[model samples]
Target chain A: MNRKELIGQIREKKSFLCVGLDTDIQKIPAFLLNEEDPVFEFNKQIIDATREFAVAYKINTAFYESRGIEGWKSLIKTWEYLPKDCFSIADAKRGDIGNTSEMYAKAFFNIESSGMSFDSVTVAPYMGADSVKPFLKFPEKWAIILALTSNEGSKDFQYLSSDGNMLFESVLQKSGEWGSKENIMFVVGATRGEDFLTIRKHVPDHFLLVPGVGAQGGSLDEVCRYGMNKECGLLVNSSRAIIYASSGTDFAEAAAAGAQAVQQEMEKWVREL
Target chain B: MNRKELIGQIREKKSFLCVGLDTDIQKIPAFLLNEEDPVFEFNKQIIDATREFAVAYKINTAFYESRGIEGWKSLIKTWEYLPKDCFSIADAKRGDIGNTSEMYAKAFFNIESSGMSFDSVTVAPYMGADSVKPFLKFPEKWAIILALTSNEGSKDFQYLSSDGNMLFESVLQKSGEWGSKENIMFVVGATRGEDFLTIRKHVPDHFLLVPGVGAQGGSLDEVCRYGMNKECGLLVNSSRAIIYASSGTDFAEAAAAGAQAVQQEMEKWVREL
Candidate 1:
């Protein structure tokens, strides 16, 4: 999905919510285990329940990869099941050298080759420009580079100061030159709400995929206040807090309730735009 | 493989050569395409030929992942076919948050879960300690962290000077505390031969998995001179140069000859010890 279409969806839905399907087999409702593909079954219901409120879906690849071939099968099926109108993100933090990265691009952005083509795939910028440029070769596809991540380990190397700019700030500045706002986005954790102020300074127009909300104790209000752009340039992701709201037969309904509550809150913020 | 066993293999084989099975479907011989599983068939031949000289086999996951389900099938088969005596590495440079990294660890380290158990897995260090620690949870497994890579883009963020050390130097310094020399390793590219002098300073005891030789124009002599230690702490990798040595029917023999040449050079380095 391109920037304009994404903004349109957010405006129409009145929410920038991107539901993260970090579905673990062990965490799903036990009854679902009786099904042939419980992981896919769980994702199908979660997508159906949250589709009304979300404008996008982010599938964390690690959750699916843990099951080997069976997990990979579920991942392909889940990708096929995602709502077409909603932007899709393969949250596979993948990057390598130029040639190898081309293979990764084929894996995620070329559905004919990899059986799944996400609108964007999360990329680690540690390997630098060539590692990321391959994903941008596809038209309208996005490369969401990791900036200031929400995890505690984000402090390890991301904050190292160089030439007065922190490592992530350098990532934001240097990577901005590699792709425009149309093809590039940054992953800015919502936990550090004020970091958005610093983030906006480098790439004001590019969308930021915000994680660390809900289960991670990040406030949606603070994210909206500091991160939201006129185009609603913030994809606030909520994974566990919404998907695992209930592990019983009522799981789908509970997920819908959780999503609706966040959507309603998001509606208030987008309404200002 | 543990530290002692890996060094023993290097000494036993009289080589520290790591043959990178970056097997691309398009690059394999056309006759192999007639087989039930061409990619795996090609890899099987390459491994059979190179097994004698190589102490390690590094499978670049991107090549297999590009083909989707069939590709993943090939990856598992390739992993299963790997010689039990040689150190196996799933060169999947994956890293994420703590829980997500745990899932990745299970994907590569836990055979019961992911259908493939590699001795080590390459991890991108952009997310820091928590993202890498999970891989170390498994006894006798290793996390080969990306410190300095071997591409033109490596200059983008890796060389950024922070305080008294460069970004890659800081990565080595900080990450050294995350795991011991036993469970931890760092990828120091062979292209920048002199950089090994600096890398050895921070990680004198930990093993360095060196890529960028042959196909990438790195020198084996220079890598050994500056990077080797008492245990000959280096696993130098060559992918395209050795694997794709020939495109005709003589491909396997050519690969054997190519691997033997590198092993001979490596033997000289180990002989000095």
Candidate 2:
């Protein structure tokens, strides 16, 4: 799916919240431990319950990855179960050499090999174009590169003066040339708060995947304030704050409620594109 | 272990080849494929076979992660099995919020719930200091941040103009201030070859985890020429070229041969340091 369709879903649902499935095994309801595929069961229930309030589902591969083969299968099964209209993300943070990346692209997007496919995948741009180009090669597939993240360490090197410019700013301006706004995006953490304004100056149209809301305390209002564009280009993610909302048997319902709250707030903040 | 200790091991072994344990399920021999934990068994065999020859083992979380819970367990077992003197890299590429990062550090280095304890981990600096700092907070544990990658799409923004500095150059200089040379390291792709000289100018004292040799065609002569430091601060990583050296039952032995070939070349190169 492309950027337009992503935004269209938000408009259709009047919500912009992207449910981040950063599921932790130990935190899931104790009941699931007895199930054959506990991870898949947890994801299935959460996805089923939260599908209504979210426009996107961002799966952090680490949580599933920490599990291994069974985790990979869970990821595949979960992807298969997600609604077709909702944008799917493989938050794998994959970026390697060109050839390896090509295979990664094939692994995630090639539906023939695995029935699971993600519309976008988070990529680390430290490898430069060759690393990122492989992901963007698919006509409609999107690559959300890391930009000015909202972490304190972002101040360490991203903002460091290299030659004369900061690294994150350089990433924003240079990476912008590889693809149009419709195909590329940036991961701008909401926790950093004000960095969004400067980020907007670099790529005014591309969507920004903003995480760090809820538990991390990144204000949703501030993220939308400086980051939003005429395209309504922002996908604010909340993970632990949603998925683990409640650890009881009603975990799925509680997650849906947490997701609903974010959607309600997003409905008021979304720009009229 | 800190940079000095890792360097000592490299010198004692007279090798810089850090064989990467990036085991994919499909890549393992057919016999082990039916095991209770194919990934862990494959890793055990490889580690046992290569432990004498390799200076370190970098466990790229992606291959294990593509699996989920089973993968996490395998990661724990691999870390446990790894020799203490040998540098154990989580290769998780994790960088998140301060609190979350602290949790990650605990998961990898602290022997609490996660029986895994790795010496180092790869982190994406896009989130800045808070994301990177939490990892650094652990006394001897280190953070291997991305500096210059060898991927195709990296040109997208990594080299873009921010005044005159390239994005990666800026990150290197900035992130250096976060931790002492004793703890911080950079991931400079070997494919960049001579660009190592350029990276060295920015981080002359810190260790570098260089990936992309062998299958990626990154030459040992070229990378060592520009990458080697006075302290011999270079942990050259070879994944596919070494781990997947053969598809047959003799894969582990073939992998040892591939690793030995690179180590022989690396031995010659280390003379300059």
**For this target, which candidate reaches the highest lDDT against the unseen true structure?**
1
lDDT of 1 at A69: 96
Could you say which candidate leads in DockQ?
1
What TM-score goes with each of the models? 0.99, 0.79
Tens-digit lDDT string for candidate 2 (A1-273):
877788788888878788888777778999999999898899889899888888889987666544544566677888888889998888866776665566567667767644557898888766677767878888889888887676656665566555555677778877866777878989987876678888888888889998888876899888888888887888889888999999899999899889888888888876455
User: lDDT by residue for model 2 over B1-273, one digit each (tens)?
Assistant: 877788888888888778898777877888897888888889888888788778889987656544444555676788888988799888766766665566567667766545667888888766677777878888888998887765555555566545556667877877866887888988887777767777888888888888877766687878887888777888889888878888889988998888788878888766666
In Å, residue B141's CA in model 1 sits off its true spot by 0.2
DockQ for candidate 1, C-alpha atoms: 0.92
Q: What is the lDDT of candidate 1?
A: 0.94
Query: Counting only residues 3 or more apart in sequence or on different chains, how many pairs clash (N, Cα, C under 3 Å) in candidate 1?
Result: 0
lDDT on C-alpha atoms for all candidate structures: 0.94, 0.78
Give candidate 2's error at residue B181 in angstroms: 3.4
